[model samples]
Target: MNEFRIIEDLHRLQNQFASLWDPFVAAGGSVYPALNIHKGSDQVTITALVSGIDPDSLDITVSGNQLRLSGEVISGAPKSDLGANRVERFHGKFQRSLELPAEVDPEKTTAEFKNGILHLTLPIRESVKPRKIQVQSK
Candidate 1:
């Protein structure tokens, strides 16, 4: 193959690999802790799995329709007498941000940490919530 043809073929292979990996990252594979978002009539609930992390180390914030979650997982140093054969769990700082589907009231938002799960409840704006309309005879 000509020099230009070789480069073009390499670029095409790179594109194919990127396309295969993009879907996994887009589906929340990159985030440290997986998240589940539930949209209700009046509120939105976000749940994250943060097992083995200290509650005090977690930080949750909401800006407009975006929610940011950040925290650090500190692993204690192994004892001098013992040596670790294998390590699998992740340790260190991680942050994940998600854009909500609708506008929410940041002031009314509430969070709870229990059983290694962080749950955030964001109340939807009253103006954007579904409402019933009445019809009148002309």
Candidate 2:
């Protein structure tokens, strides 16, 4: 019974160690075009790493508080006879949708791609902006 307990504890310890590397590889196997977003009082800024993809192939859409990103990544296969033995890079059509913290104006939103990074600036809707009310005394 003592040996079984010891084995279980070891297994738990191994799992903890494995989780330490989770941040780097956790969503790596599945999620593509990872995003980083920043929200301010008047706007929201989003950044996504999209290396090795053509700018013309990307499509971005925004509706209310929802933002959609769709694109395709083409693989650069080698022409050598040896061919590829190990392939790890992601390639294909991928779409990711994110909900914004505040409603945004899609008409005013701007997208820029430079150095393999897609940067978006979405202005918060005028209706959603906070306004101050004046107080009256009798």
**Tens digit of lDDT per residue, candidate 1, span 26-115?**
654534566788999889998899988999999888977888888987765465655554444555677666678888999999999999
The TM-score obtained by model 1 is: 0.72
Best by TM-score: 2
Tens-digit lDDT track for model 2 on 1-138? 345445545654543454445352365423467678899999999999898899999999999999988899887766675635555555667677767889999999999999989999999999999999899999
Query: What C-alpha lDDT does candidate 2 achieve relative to the native structure?
Result: 0.78
Clashing pairs in 2: none
Lowest summed lDDT across 10 adjacent residues in model 2 is found at 22-31
What RMSD does model 1 have?
9.9
lDDT (C-alpha) at residue 122 in model 2: 100
* Candidate 2 root-mean-square deviation in Å: 10.4
Give the distance in Å from residue 103's predicted Cα in candidate 1 to where it truly belongs.
Answer: 1.3
